[model samples]
Target: MSGREPIVPLVRRFSPTLSPSDDESTDSEAVHPYLFGKNSSGWEVIEEKRRCVIIADAGAGKTHEMLARARYSAERGRYAFFIRIENIREAFASAFDVGDAESFEKWIGSEDDAWFFLDSVDEALLQDPLAFEEAMRAFAARIADARERAYIIISSRSYAWRARTDRQLLDQLLPYESPKANEIGEEEIEEAVQTGMSDPNKLTNSIDVVILDDLDEDDIRMFAAHLGASDIEEMMQEIKKAGLSSLSSRPYDLLGILTKWRSDRQLGGRLGYLKHSIAVQLDGINWTACSIDPSILPEAVGRIAASVILTGKAEIRVPGSANDERGFDPIEVLPDWPRENVVALLDCTLFTDAVYGVVRFRHRDIRELLAAEWFADQLANPERRAEIEAMLIREKYGERILTPRFRPMLPWLVLLDDRIRREVTAIRPEIAVEGGDVASLPVEERRSLFHSIVEQIAEGKDDRGARDNDAIARIAHADLSSDVAALVERHAENDDALFFLGRLVWQGQMTDCLPLLLDIARSRSRGLYARIAATRAVFTTGSKEQRDTLWDSLLEVPNKHA
Candidate 1:
């Protein structure tokens, strides 16, 4: 037979009640008994209380192994804090919105005498660099100071780079062996056969425990069976184009070939478009093409868009009136633009929208695309490069949006700014104001301006849920802008605003607001609050339609109170 080594099969015992859905092994029923360290070397490692880091590339069974260990510890009555950092950050931030810092700290540090599994630290660290560093250091400090015993295990992509002890241990454990120099020829095999005949049991001790098995041609065919026809075609093309036909069959090489094909359309015609249009604008150039440094990417985008965002030109304008009369000045001709000496500025207002990621293109595609092309050429256009360089100033330092919380807000800002600039110019004649400067006016004056704008907007339109919240807040209560009452009109027949106002009324212990509530119940849709609130408010007002609408909204709330 062929001289392949045998694998030492270890018995893998598992909990009898485990199901496939519990693949992450979080549930007690899903714990595998065989995988527990008590039955294997894993037990010794954990018992030593030595810091351990398991290093593996993506899809290398890291999560499964980590989950098994966590479940094992938890089964023995130990608390386990399985913190998916991304989820924790989102949860903590939301909690902070309605609570305080102490509440957030308590939530994260809830579990006592626990084994903490901080999984996917790479994603956690990358998303919020500052928060990750602070949290990690703080956690280490907390665990150190804890009164009870707590085991902390952190899984991170950077473990290989940062865990010096683990690296050294792994290096020391590696076995180096080579075939004996004298056992090379056919005579040696004959001599070994005779020796084995004399001592048949000798073969047992000579076998290598871990052998690297080479994939034979038939094994490659079996792998091809795992891939669909399209993937096979793509793989073949990648191998041919990369000129790695001889080595492409290796599993790691095969994966890399697929990734490159997906990332770049260099070889495949059906590779598809990049998500953003700007990706097309920078065609054939590397993402790092400008060599400006990634540290400056966020700041560069921010500074370039800052003028557009604040000036009102960047806001989403209602159709037409794309001219400067609406404050849409093309910044290409503007003076004092830094980096002006390094590149030619395209002559168009850099209109941006939040599509296919944060897209920033000129409103007129033809003009913007032309500018994008010309600006790209500046790298090699020796003549204009210096001028472009002079146009953009080098700021001391800077950094990086979403949700009403903070995220998604940047896109809203871009959209709102554009809309405001355009509408202000169009409505300038209606209001005798100095330009479109809302901040320049006194607080009361601004409030007056907001009221006029809202009244003008609501004059003839059917009262739908669409109300200008900021305007309403400015008009009603400037100091309490974040409160819902600040956004509704003192008098409007919109059910949504009324329902929101109902809660405020409820809080104030006032029932005299029924007239306004009655007007809203008759004119618009209903059931924006809990059933009891809606029912109580409607019955108190004595309206048939309001009670019926309350019934409908009750159906919408799952598990609603009677």
Candidate 2:
């Protein structure tokens, strides 16, 4: 056996900090330690509950971490089944060589702690996400209804779940703005219907969620040490730079960043970081490698990804599958794309040969990022602008680029074309909440949208409660530009909406919201949660005199939520 130190990545439980409707009964829950050691505690945590969903950003090592943990569990004589969601059809088929249906049933009859690790929820079943949803529900049902005492774990990207991340884009998930019954125009009603659609968070709402935290500096240092870097101090210096902090924290990107940094090339944002990873592969460094031109790879892969994702398929192509009605040919995605160059990349580290001759990017996130980037960049050229834009925007609701598969392209498109952002926001306020910075928009429009968002957050709505909160949070960040004072007014004036606002202000003591919060704290009309949240928001950042004043004033109020 090759004896080497195993690096265990840190992970944490996903809390309900943003969920205002949560019940206050989580105190008895396991306080999952931020750090894990060589012992099997980290692995055991998965079985502590029946279902767990582990989420992280692209290339952050979700699959690797889960695999490592599963291996560790198996070595410890625990029952575990690792299933790549995409291959569920053949999962059990491939899971055994000697066992037939009878043997498998017998094995399951006696097995407990037969953990199932569903790799990526976003990529669970097929290239097409529609099929993925069906498979995901089936698996969820299996997990929920399993007679065996089995554990299940699924993972997904952050943006796939929420807009809090730096990489979030304009989401097409039907915004909180449901069309009022009084809308005068048919087109506007259609637009509202289109903007309001699905809420995916419900997919994992019943299961416990744990976010795999980004590797800290020490973790990065350990990784660098394993890579045999002699001057880690200087490497750490560069890593600490504001630009690379997020990049350095991710294992896959860290490897690429360090490898390229040694060459003394300047790296900037995600585009540069992701591009460099593929560049190293294209530099002819590994098996089945070619030193073909690196400039076109991103676009080649992007075009292919766009075609696949837009078509509602996993976007994977199965070669020589004319008889196999499941998918299409890779070359057909973009007729003008360089076929020879794209085909060359199909077998390299940058891409993987899925079962049979089917091909896809070795890294899924890279394909998505490049697809969005390529489409956005194409708009810069006058010749391709109309074709790309029209292909993206469709008359069908939630189809075309508006689908989740194309969510990555939303931010890029909005940023590239400001006028479209304004137009979409005018049609529906909630859609543009995720578009980008709110401070850049005109104040009057922002005020109008803010009111619309508040109206959208009306009491007793389940489908859009969280979406409305996210819209509010996005607008809250515009302390510099948006008219937040309007929110303090009888905007909905409902306890739920106020609690949502109080939670936002409580997040980090947004000082501008201090006065309104203090008022809410003293108001007898507000609900207990709303007032307590307002009180805590003040104590979190208010002066000693202000804190004491609020504390003393709250003497008569109940302490339930505080």
Candidate 3:
């Protein structure tokens, strides 16, 4: 089962404790991923809640788990069906022998205890966003109008919960305050789901949201052992030694690591892993089997990826279509390449999935990474950079690069364009947190970019002084530990800065911040909250020796302060 069985993984039901002000969100709050939990996974939740929305990062394996759930239902002799968003109309029309999506919508929820796993809403949005949203709301309405009898599960790449109204529409009990890293545990998982069915008046109306956690150590090793990787222990040790423990924790990234395990290589950062994986995948091709050169695949795929960025479309439908907004023949982008050969190669590649002749990168993250690399190469030219900036900002043309879908690619864009510095600081400072880690980048430039954002944080306290533990923990990527540690040291006197630092330490992979936390915890001059925050972090992540030192400091605290 890959240790991914549906179970009651830790979940944060909307807290009943939200204050009135929690309903209002600022700009930054509008784009954040919600809390992720580990426990029993999507399978159990689907069985328990008649309607559930599973959200996760791209490549966190939502599609795979959904299929598994469908199988589980079938073995039990329950009716179950899986649907992808791209071919929603075609698939439904084919299944029910109907004419179009509208007719199919009318036909769904026709069977009681029937489970419909609607997958890949994010990819659908990338193509036809308005249509996708309407389809979901419509399908949900169909489920609702059916006397609330049909079972349903939906999954999406993490999209920001845009408004309080949106939260209410989903029937979230209360707005979540951007979760903290250490605030969750199985014991506190919101009473294992309270859904619309429990309330007689609200049956099937509430769609409870759950995010699948990344592969924990046991899950990672299970997959490794399942794959029969030689020297699994050595492989795990090597990954940890490379400071890639964070990346390896992700199911998608872990599979890449395990599949390409070699005692000799350093997987490097995310970009490095991509490069290595690309080379390895290219190796899987037998050049003698065809006229196409191995290098051609990357060139073609890279161009296709860049096209996706400019168009905000993930699919390149074969032969094109008059009605498909996302459709484009591959040859249209690469006028020189043979359409059949390129599509064949792409379909064979591990990194892509071809559904009913419509091809998409296996995950949006892959698409974003490839596009980033391609754009970085082009942005090297000053004139091209100017053209791109104009187009991205114009909002009417090539592709709106400023959209949230493009955020993953912005760090790569920033690497080549100096003019984007303001946007980096003001719009998406998390760019610095993510980009600081690439093995190939210049550390000084990234550090400079990060500190400017930190200064912005120094501006003032958050309205409620609530910690966005998820956002803060994201900064604790192992590669960024030193950069974060330096920033913490620089802002030891700034309570806000210290507060952010404390969060990173306990809730994040902040191995480098222990000494600094100890120093602050032992300092009598710091605020009680700051000292307490630092003390918690020290005790949480410190070594036995470090804990002994912290214990000694604690003993002296009353007398020393007195």
Candidate 4:
């Protein structure tokens, strides 16, 4: 009732088919040797057994085998659910148009005759290991009842499988050793990519299980043909020589290569040159290297996003005038992103529906990275300085007047010096002293400006007892809490300020300021503020007297609020 149902036990007698091995003998002349191989005999046993687990290393031909079995079962007119385990719950539910519990029951009908193909079981395990085990238990129970009528097939990365020793369901499967000449061909690949077989037993008579020893040979030959061309092909050869050939396996990398070639049509004219360019970029790193190598990609991607969002430039143009005798600057080579880092940065920048990709840190994470003190220190270099300055202007300050509300734009302003300068001219600007400059004004003048701005916005508003809600929210996130707090203290009975201060109190507990955070938390709310005060009192405040005072204060809040 909770999860998926158990597969029914096999009731009908089926031949005990053995998994094919070169040494194994076949009883039926009708069975295709290519399809079943040695395990051809095990088909009977597998069918009778009900549930099954198939384990193999990466590139071990598990997909080929799963396809073979799925095709066989489907041919028999049985409803076959071939699901990739990456999205197990959704996949199962969709198959039955039911929830998880109902899907399990459907798969584990009383008669016990269903085939479920699950690919990449590791994904489910990685997300939630407990649910995976529970699901397997339900599967095994149903398989026991269904016997020859029901079964489960699963494929997972061998490395992940080796990690969880407690999974008894897998321990029972105990994988068969991989064969020596283990290779899957185009025929098998095509069948898998297309729809699979319907009938398990009648497969041999219905379709040919063709096999070819060579798989990638045709793709290799096509590459050779492209290189034989005269023009662009030569460029491609150079790129290959430079090391770009290694990225073909990654879809994104391939897309990047094609996109780059398209943008530079002159280079595109020669196919060879394009290929060579790809080769040069991808030369040192292959798919495996991307997966296994220690990565600087995250940092690199952060830098790229920083350059774009902080600096107005897209990083795809030449930095300086080309007429100068200097060779093309490395930074100006256009789209000069570090290839290995693109994936990491892209992950952080692009927010999407949670179900499709890995969950990411909230938007605040990017803000924190950009606001790091290191970035502030490096702004002296023209490029770095330009990027940071542009970022501050775009994100923090705007034209016309100073905004009275503190929105944590200090994360931007913090990078610059204390003496904030005003632009003398809008058209072609130079720093100038003017009434517009917040930093240039004396303390009294600045406070008067701040108060006037607030009064103008709050005129005739019922919310005068507190700061603007939006303003308070912004203040709560300010980088320099002291400065923000000082600004708030200047106002009379600003409850919105207190509320914002409370949030900062909470954030501060997670950040640098801890001891003083309690004061801010307690200063905010009279009632539910008890929770925050209690947490602080228990963990941060040292003396029992302080704790008691805080607890009593919290207890008194309810009566007072009531």
Cα lDDT listed for each candidate: 0.34, 0.53, 0.57, 0.35
Could you tell me the lDDT of residue 328 within candidate 2? 56
lDDT of 3 by residue, 1-562 (tens): 0122223232212111111124344322322222112334445545666656676655567776776667667667666667765545433442221123453354453555566777766666665546455565655544555534556666766443222443454454211222333554544343334321233323334445565666767777777777667777777788866656766766667767765676344455566676676666656654444568776677677788888766766667754324343446667788886655664556555444444456666655566666766776666777797775654444535533355556656655655456664554455455644432333456665455446556666665332112344334434545567777887888889866686667667765577788888899888789755676687788888888888997897777375545
What clash pairs does model 3 have?
A: 6-44, 7-40, 7-41, 8-40, 9-39, 9-40
Q: Model 2 Cα displacement at 173 (Å)?
A: 25
C-alpha lDDT of residue 255 in model 2? 76
By lDDT, is 2 or 3 better? 3
Global CA lDDT of candidate 2, please? Answer: 0.53
lDDT per residue, candidate 2, 443-534, as tens digits? 66656666665566544322232242223444554342224444655642576556656655654246766777787888777776667566
Candidates 1 and 3 compared by lDDT, better number: 3
What TM-score, over all chains together, does every model reach?
0.25, 0.62, 0.71, 0.28
TM-score of 3: 0.71
Count the clashes in each prediction: 32, 8, 6, 70
Q: Which candidate, 3 or 4, has the higher lDDT?
A: 3
Pick by TM-score: 3 or 4, better one: 3
Query: Quick one: ranking by lDDT, best first?
Result: 3, 2, 4, 1
Q: Write the per-residue lDDT of candidate 4 for residues 1-562, one digit (tens) a residue.
A: 0111112121211121212223323221111112121222334454433344444322234544555566667677665556545344433343221123454566567564666676555444534545455555544544454544545555554323422232334444322222222254545445544434333222222111211111132332243344342334543554344333433222222333444554453322112333343333333333432452335433443444344333322122123323222112224322555543333333332221121222221122232233332354555456677655554444334453222211122323332343222221121111111111233234543344334434432232222211221122222222344543453354324433333343433433323333344444345343333233324423552356555655565455444655
Give the winner by TM-score. Answer: 3
For model 1, what is the alpha-carbon lDDT of residue 97? 12
